[model samples]
Target chain A: MPAHSFRLLSLGIGIVKLLRSSDWLIVPGVLLLAFFFVAPTVEIALSSIFDEGLTGKHFERFATKGAYVEVFRRTLVRSVWIGILCVLIGYPIAYFIVHRSLRTQVFLMLLILVPLWTSILIRTYAWMVVLGREGIVNNALIWLGLIDKPLRMMFTTGAVYVAMIQILLPIAVIACYSAMTEIDRTLPRAAKVLGASPWKAFRHVFLPLSLEGALTSFVIVFMLSMGFFITPALVGGRKDAMLANVIAHNVEQLNWGFASALALLLLVATIIVIVVVRLLANRFVGVRSVGMAP
Target chain B: MSRKMGNPGSILLTAYTVAAIVFLFFPILIVIPMSFSGERFLGFPPKTLGLRWYMNYFSDANWIELTLRSLRVGLGSSILASVLGTLTALALARSQIPFKKAITALFAAPVVVPTVIIALGVFIFAVRSRINDSELTLIAAHATIALPFVVMIVGAAARQVDPTYEKAARVLGAGPVKAFYYTTFRALMPAVISAAIFSFFVSFDELIIALFVMSENHTLPIRIWSDLRFELDPTIAAISTLLIVFTTAAMIVADRLRRRSARKPDA
Candidate 1:
């Protein structure tokens, strides 16, 4: 009996200790995050701005050089285009899945998800093989007597677009589909019952409700597109270069200072774009949930 | 049905679906026939059926070594990430950990950031530390990349797990550790396993960081990348086909387990 009482006392002490030490649990987690994330970000920022002494030479180089400025401009434009393209292509598919029966929706979702499970590099490589000069499209075109010479499909801006949009479309679809599923089906049905045309009901009810998800998806795809490297490098020409490719090249060349500057610039660009997307989404949709990217 | 909307929407949707499927699957599908080509170089309509490239990949010592090295790094990183990630998940889920949002965000940051950036950071850090780009260092880098996913998925699962079981065990005179081991850990087994499998695949398929970190020793993707850069070989196609088959098998197994758990009654 005495031993059992002692055990009970110890258990009581343990419970008190657990409650008292709740904050300790976060220490390791915080340390890990700080070491991996905060430290590296600080390092990059420092390396970019300072070279032996404090100087903005790296930023100056980006400003003075027309090539860097052009690359930045093109990267932004290309990413936005790709994001818009994904939304356009993905919305119908997302709508189809959301409107279908549960079983049918699951099947379609699986189809979309299976390809996403594979590596993006593998997917991009597949495109390179398909879009090459002697690839399937070229061979088919020749056989159909469409062109006298093989078309230059690979290593072009168009090729980059095709690959990036294909990779990012699934994300948009999934995002919009999840959001669409949340909206009450009866709301749209009520519009139909109130003498509204199907198209008009969809535009006024469904579109407005789903806009937030669509916008969030757009922001995510845009940010991801900005950071694209392997796809563009493998399939894009020199002119199709994004900021990510430039950062990668600098890293390879052992120019860490320049690489950090490029990386920090990319980060800043992404943050600004995300902020703009959120503000626009909030004003247009009047819903905060739709502004957040998954 | 409204003819005004139905016809055009259906046509557009069907056309887009077909085009998207063709865009997504054509490259993956074309590799199969090309893998069997008798010709030395890659061609769309492979001249003849032959097992030469498949034979070449199997016999090539360099390719075999790289494949084995990749397997080692992948397996090591997967195991490491899963253990640490799952532990961190438990702390986040069960404990009253402060700054929950910040912690979770940090864990998932690797997914958001471009991998090339991470590679550069690790490369710079490694260079300064004088750490050689060996298999161990590469595995560490890969583990860091995969850790966040394991934490996120496992934590989500853990949040749904019942606390009553552990509480009951503890009330029945079991120690905290013993109660957790008997009740909570068993309940979390399926999620932990699933998270481990996903982390494994993330490590296995990673290429960019491996490329940045390793030069003398190459992973499977690195090998294929280098081969593509030097020359377009049928052997690379064969290797890709093999990877597709293996990945599909692993995915099926994971999916089956998920389904089985979904069908099982709560414990």
Candidate 2:
């Protein structure tokens, strides 16, 4: 080949190598997230300290405020309960579906996915209707001669738990069902054949196998509940307020530093819980079966 | 394996599942009737059956405007996120990126963390950047959240199939762009479509970020939020029922498309 042709061929090779590498395609997307997502997160973490020099004034305000402290405590406490409630409600449903025919499992899972796709606001509003004084629950009770007047069931702590669990229960079920379905149906059967009772077979074999999924589901539900604002704000009483509500209130008040502080606190709390779960689950069991994206 | 309807435990399990399903869907069922109620207050089993609230939602100029605005935002963010996220997914599937795990984690970060934190973060950042309330900022903010879903759906779709056709074309000395243009893109088209639809819903349904980042441009959820805060009306219920039907259809379609594509072999 001529010298100029050789040069052209080499240039062509370099271009192919670059194209074959292909990872450059990720830059535009990553850059967008870097500026918008990661940068904002960093700004939030720093905002509590970055207001007019490095000061903890924002966090200091949070720490000093009894109301703020109370909201954080309530958020943490309620989230744990929501997680437990979800699992208690979810496990049996998942176990039932897991034991069903493949077609039934698919159909049942689709039923669960319907409410999952529905809007959170609509779900919250539904609870308001059902639990309201003149809502169906109250109306039914009145008609049954159980009560002379409508009961005030809306705007209570129980209302919050009910709605939140309803909103989040599908997630727990799907997670656990996915894991439960992966277990060999014969393991528990084999245990039963070996003289263990049916209950013991499940406890010794099925429960141990499925618990990791339940734990993962719990973590997810718990994390999401901690950040919940809409359901709590819409259906909850003043006492039912979570940290997310407090953060939103602060944001609305144009108190950016304080809002950022509250957001950071919630984020830290979420991270801590997740890390603890990961450590415990990784050490103890088959949490790798968790269906959540890593 | 021994589960039977006659067994006490099995019967209890059956009842619990039924109750759980009711609990899951009860709110949705309650609102459907309320939306048709001629009554002004929020009560189910309407005293009179009519589409008064539905008519109100459709006829009201403000509601229509917010609906159009939300569609625009949803489409805009969907396109941006789908393109960006699809590219990232393809990149991850085909080649090595530096700190790929960390990069993927960052992409997924928005979904895991609370939306309030993200809203607060973006709000504070926007204030500093002076793009706090712009439509562009809102689109960018939503796309960031929706990006992860696109990546997730498309990444899963991309990983399921062999990319040998593209690789083979490359080895046969087809230009890199031309080979991919001809091969992988065609194969991944169904998943790409699914991802776009999913991304649209993610942005369309988002409210918290919009509440913090948007001021003049009110989305549908924002409108609903304002109304719910000020008054308990049947119109909100009407909107909810309509959205529930629409979203359920979208999800079913998306799921079917996903299953079809997963079953298809290199088509």
Q: What does the interface RMSD come to for each candidate?
A: 3.2, 1.5
Worst 10 residues of 2 chain A by lDDT: A285-294
lDDT of 1 by residue, A157-183 (tens): 999998888788888888888889889
What DockQ, on C-alphas, does every prediction get? 0.41, 0.68
lDDT of 2 at B13: 87
Q: Give a tens-digit lDDT track for model 2, residues B53-87.
A: 99999999999998888889989999999999999
Residue-wise lDDT of candidate 2 within A160-267, one digit each (tens)? Answer: 888999999999999899889789888888988999998999877898888888998899899889899899898888888899888888888988889888888898
lDDT per residue, candidate 1, B148-258, as tens digits?
Answer: 877876676677678898899999999988998998787777767777777778888887778877867779888777666656777888887888778767766665554
Give per-model TM-scores: 0.90, 0.92
Cα RMSDs of all predictions?
5.6, 4.9
Poorly placed runs, candidate 2 (over 4 Å): A1-19, A283-294, B1-5, B169-178, B263-267
Evaluate residue A211 in candidate 2 and report its C-alpha lDDT on the 0 to 100 scale: 84
